[model samples]
Target chain A: MATVKWPHFFHFSAPHSVVNTPAHRPDTRRSKSYGRSCVEPPSLFWQTPGHLTTLGHRIPTSRRAAKSHNITTKVDPEQVALLIKNEWKLSHVTPLYRFRHTQLKLYSKHLAAFIIAEKQQGVAVEVGVEAGFKVTFSAVLGIAETKEDAETVFIQVHSKPLFSADTPKAVWRGWLTCVNGDPEYLRSLPPDFVSLPLFCSSGPEYLTALVKSWFERTFDCSFGSLYLNSTMLNWLAALWTGCHPTSNIRYLKLAWNMPSQPPLDIAYTVNPQDAWELWNSIHTEDSTDDRINIEEVQLFMNGLEIHFFRHFKIYLSAGTLTKVSTALGSAHHDGKIKIGSSDYITTLLTLLTECALMKTPV
Target chain B: MDEQARAILQRVIRKIPNKKLQTALRAWDHLSSEQLESLDYAQPKWLFLENLISRCEENRLSLKDVTKLEMAYYIDNPSKGTWHAYQLFQAEGDAVSVNFTQFREQLKAHLKDVVRHVSVRTKKLEDGAVWIRIAWGDNFSKPNHLKPTYVVHYLQTSYVFVLNLMSKHKPFLYQALLLSTRHVSIKEAQLSSRSLTAMRDLLMRQYQQVFPTNQERTLKERNAPPSHPSIEKEHAECAERRHQMACEAFGDGVLPKLETAVYKLETKYRGNSNNTLNDKDELFRGVVMFSSSNLLESFRHCVSAGMAEGPVTPLLSSITQKGRNSFVITDKVPGAASQTPAHKA
Candidate 1:
């Protein structure tokens, strides 16, 4: 069965000799390292569960020469174009549309890997004080397979920074067409353009609006937890995609929805002097000698204002990350963290007092 | 010749789809009478029949499977096959029990349906071993147009193995530990209890190398540690080094909060599996804080450092040179609103 000259019947069309061609049967050579000699290279064609005929044989055809024969019978080019245009419009305008319509592409494998890893890590949802209230945003970065399929690219829709030299070139090429719609301009780009770290902002005004809404929803009632709205979550996911080389916090102030009573917004801001004193005292309180648990370090750092030194410490410490990210994602999406905890309320008030005092001392 | 064999052949041939039947018939017709005569033995005929049935099954399995084309592209690439072959050699030395034939036949049998599954498919065998099939390809086209080059089979955590029929060593092993950019935790891979420690240690080494803690750098800077550094010492050293690196990378006067932006980028670079830059180069390349004071100087530092490395320099310089123009600032809202009539509503 192994010696059957079966592959001879189906000649590979390529003029160049490929190793898989019947003419070149795999040899019985020993690898220098493996120490295992080939008994018989497994037959490319194998016996089926029930014997019938050999498969995987190729027929010779010069694809270049015969390519024209495969073309579909022509319709009017204008009509074809119009049909495609109408189809695209129908898909995009459909109320049930889930995928975004855009020409930009992203790294497919990287995007897949990122999404899988991120979902496992889970997005952190924090319903806490920043300017008013802050929730971590996520973004999707996608790779457009084709112009028609761009609608189905992994629909991460907001703009943030993507940090990596390994970012695929196709992503930038498609993005150039999406944003500029100029072929000449895309051609003008340097060969290495797509590999650069990219940052796309929804702009200061838009980000502030997102925060304002986040604050409004959280303050609507004293609650157990506040889940992030789907709209904001979607916006965050879009912005975070394809953008990396990031900071510990990418924050926007919610001055638009500042609570007028008690001027709580003013207290939210951290006084660096006070924050440092708190941090030092935590370590030195009982004795000069103090050993901190990794968990406490994380909690302490999470409570620090974005302006505080503890913010940088969180990222640099053995890749140690707090539940802050998880807390944020969960508080917004899963509604797990209870707001009734005295510790949480105190922290919130402390943050508010810091902001309020920083503005106009009580 | 045998009654039972002939009956079985007839039954199997009936299962072949019309498209595959055509292929089998065409292949049969292409064979000369002498060649046909050579396949008179029951064994050869049996092999032929089996091949036909397998082909039909493959066609059915691949139907509507979006990622098949992409997988084929990777499988067909000779260079990638050889590279994986080398990797398997290093990882599997006598430890892996499955020979090439058993692994190949099992993979070929299940690959079709597994590739088409909607969610990522991971199957743990009865023997307490786990295997996952990940489809990999560039975003050139959708899963259908381009054949995927490789369907990576990560076996436990000890090895990532593949059998490339395309390689010169057809049906040989390829190891992919150093080559693959995708980093799934060893625990996620679910290794045998015995190999777990070894694999975890190997992964830890790789992780630490990529994301050297400040303690690791400081200890290296000192040439030697006075003793085994405690966890607190390590954290403290790391924190101090981080502060110094932040000041040097950004500026002394930069806000600690603002400085974190650069630190975060460094941490990200550290965490990334694909970055090829050394620690020093990473410092320059990864510190991407957009300081108002002198963004260009920082970018210039990256380019100059990046030039020492050949591959990353172009990418580093490209972002630096084109950074300003890359982002487009567009209005989020329309200038005016048009209200449709209540009748339409």
Candidate 2:
């Protein structure tokens, strides 16, 4: 049996962007206040000016700004297929202390046994040997941008449900991976730790929580809930809208929270061509095809808001942008996401990684 | 009582609710204690005011003294107006040394020095909160009592809450706050609540907060998670963890009520696109507000619940992690404008 592996930090020096609009921020004194202890052995990494700076709209790194590049061939098609089908809930994991990839098989056996033991409470279930549920852990390679990035690990849970003769159906899917994490921050951690901060899961509520708890016990790490705010949804909408000319992003749909007595939810669905046109018009001066700057995204959003106001006598901007969707992907402010296409999966992953890293208590 | 009798106390007396009339009068401290004891508050509201106005006329109180009555009412019932919090940054040396009385003196002197046409009244609430009421005017006009701004601050904390402050007077008020609190600058905390108490409690984390520990939870609490064989949720430990995380991020039990969290964006749009607002120091000036009866509680529910696809993201978890509901996103990398990863959305 093959053992699970972790993501590699390939492009360790590569800088990443942060998420959210203007959310309230506390000072650095509360750094990693969520986790039990963020005590990393003092190293040369202390020289870099670090604090909550990495948590917000931080200092951008590359000499050439972040532009979307085609990473389709490098990533596994099967992995992309699994991601694009379902919406994902995101959680940020602290550095996994003493999380040995070499012992993944052992961990899998333990988790499977744990599930069985948990399912039928108070029963002395036989450990190992595939009980009622089966848990498999596998490495997903080629997704990491830098060597400092831990290679991705994918986990699946399958159940027979008394199938006896029927094939056991897959019940849960989740992965732990980080792309374009701050190299300085990753390096600063104690060598025993692997920083795969981003954890995405699709499964039953109890199962997801159980898996998370098991990881916490084994790895000495805590998971945090991260919701994508409206600013992020707008960013996603524009990013997908820009991909319209390259790949057909069937439609641009957005949801908002109205400033009403009983908070109202409003959704706007725009034709792909119209959104693309508005997007192109906003970026007429840039002439660049690959780069979709935040300013352009804002302007595109503003155009839609203006149009919406003209019709309904409501300033859509006055309402918070709660969710944004296209044929490629849809992200909710509540931290739910659907990756409809694999073309922009890398971009999506990269964005999520920054978010996860930002939540890292260290 | 005719207008003649009521005029002695100023028209603002009617603005005070009939229920709080006694407290307001007592706080005003204008009339003699013996006269106050003699007044019959249970009588018809107008008759009560008539007897009070006759006493005020005998005392020869001025219109300025009448505004004191209003300030007293506001100071006692702070929840009557909306309060916004501002953070005092770069506070140096012995910031918390000043007591409420000392702070009042410092503030009044500082405002008087900065601008002549201003009246500053300071009162310390029983709860250790220092309330400052300021009526402002330019060099030409006197301090306007009709639209005064009230500020509340606790000596130990860096946050200062204010109510009914106009934009034009923010700088003056900020300067007075800096000098009085010994802080370098004052900026909006971006968190506002319907009442002053709720905002303080939320900021101070004075409620039941959940945290993860090595010890196991009670069997009863663990079993609280809904159980069904189909979803295989028989594991109560997992559900407990979600609840713990949610409670850790946002306090459980009766949570503090915050009406709104407003984010004022001065962040550079770093999409690397042709939007005119990009680069050259142009910021995407925008505002986003999240409002609810209990914003923190609602946020906790969203984070705790499982999404159809997966679960909550880090962005959602950041509110509690950062410990602030208000933020100003700026381009930290001033020169390297093109750095984009993770932030594409």
Candidate 3:
């Protein structure tokens, strides 16, 4: 049924609980023991369900907020600019089977052909720059924090309508990445799979669906929307507000929505320095790791909510923290994100990945 | 009829609409068919009640018989109040069972032995739901039908759905349930719904639950879309695996309808020190709740449509596996709190 070498179809034959790292165990060093997975391999995919087990899901117990950095100097500035500009719709992709970063150019041709073919039933359309929709798949290099981490794959679709300009302009852009992905989970894979857990697309739903379908067919992976809830939005807000000292956040802007009889929306803006001062007042860092706890983050948000309540006579926490934006970038609770700057991209993706992992079935 | 019994009967009959009187009486099946035919159900509610009380008086009905009619109404309207589910844990490997008669005797004996003036009545529905109505009284008062707790449990399953239970009587009720069912202890299962039957159907696994199977999924060649021969699916294996995983995590077809899943986090605030919640002596408590018109359906779509990555996380899967939606996360492991009444996940 597939163009890949394997004829027989394989499903999640991997045990839900692949390895017991004790990484999430409170008070343990939060390092993924990469060597352990190599020593004790997950029961092979070809193995029976009887072999499947649960050591418990690999979710982190604690995490630190994103610190400011200059990612453009380390990565391609063009890629950084492209990433920071578009408000990408986020989804989590299952591990891709036999996806090789070295062969993205070939993948590009195949995907473009597949998309064109799907769009026009049996029409003979030669897929390339001349084609109405030209797809380009490139390796966004230097995002992988470990050897096990696969190079991020960036995809762009250029559209040139029948009577439009001669030059084909980019109509859509997306990327699949795993920056500082759970090393244990990446290592646990049988080596044929690429664990790119985060998928972000900026395009029309129609074209995005086609592209996703192509990726699903070609790579044999699945994608699910990753909705960033209000808690996550609050996390983003506090984290970005913390970055104001290093890189001016301009103004900390927050939007909230509560389901009242008439429905209410609150858009609160605070001076970057004021938000930063409030964050510092509540965010006490006694440890050398310079980490911020979930409690402190919640407290910082509470301080804002209380302040808002004191002035406006309405509790903001009653509604959702729908949107949080600053000089760094903006993120919506519905899972759309504009990077604004590449500095904290890893931090955002890492948090998203962790949040994604928390959805494991009971 | 006894004065108390007459008042209880009057109130019970009044609660039922004029139209449902016949069906409710038939369900009660206490009054003779001839006597039922003799009365006028279409008369004013007060007249109807007075008429019914005279008939009961002529029959010399006891308090117990009057309670039967009240039970009948409650049994008909199982949707009277909100029901919370609790799972019973047995100490040993072998699960224990009790027949209807034995359970009734044991429950009545346990409650009567504990409280002097307590009134406990048991009735079994056709679908094996044992409905127990208990009226409580303090040292000075007689058992009051005005305030009664309804306990519903399927004889075979471990769940007990209680409606309007007083916290003061919880340990006593738990004791009775444990003795009646031969289970050791009971803990809140944290699942609640307005419909008692919904809770029962969910915990009892009345609906189908999908599991991973070795059967070949033969995709009909006719269903394939016409394609330009140049493009082909390189990784059909993954698509198949994800579909199967989705089905396994969330059952195929119409998913179970659960409106909410709440988690009360009482775990220690293990964080960077100097945080107010990081008190070593006291645990930090927070509630994370997910609500939708149909929560399980939403989660199923989240899994099937690829909003949630596979293999499904234990937290979401715990909904079906634990047959529960509410969880209390404590000092134990993060996933452990959602497992069962007693066993940690």
Residue A222 local lDDT, model 1: 11
TM-score of chain A, all candidates = 0.16, 0.80, 0.81
Give the per-residue lDDT digits (tens) of candidate 1, residues A1-362.
Answer: 24322212113211212232234222111111011124333342222323221111111111110001111123233222211211010000101111122312323333433433433456564434111211222222221112221111212223222454342321110011121111222232222122111111122433323322322232221101123333222222211110111211122111111111111111112222332333342332334332333333333343332222211211122111111221111112221122211112222222222222122100
Scored by lDDT, the top model is 3
Q: Which stretches of candidate 1 lie over 4 Å from their true place?
A: A1-204, A207-347, A359-362, B1-65, B70-102, B107-158, B161-345
In CAPRI terms, model 2 is classed as incorrect
Better of 1 and 2 by DockQ: 2
lDDT of each: 0.26, 0.67, 0.70
Worst 10 residues of 3 chain A by lDDT: A27-36
| Interface RMSD for each of the candidates | 17.1, 11.0, 12.6
Q: Which DockQ-derived CAPRI band holds candidate 3? A: incorrect
How good is model 2 by TM-score? Answer: 0.45
Q: Using TM-score as the measure, name the better of candidate 1 and candidate 2.
A: 2
Most accurate candidate by DockQ: 2
- TM-scores of the candidates are 0.20, 0.45, 0.45
lDDT of 3 by residue, B1-345 (tens): 777888888888888999989899888887899989998989999999998888888888888887788788878887777788898887434345478989899999998888778999888878788889899876778888878899988886788999889888888899988888888888888788777766776788877667455323433232264354343453354555555666677676555556666655454544444544345455433444555656666555544444445777666677888788776555655666533332333
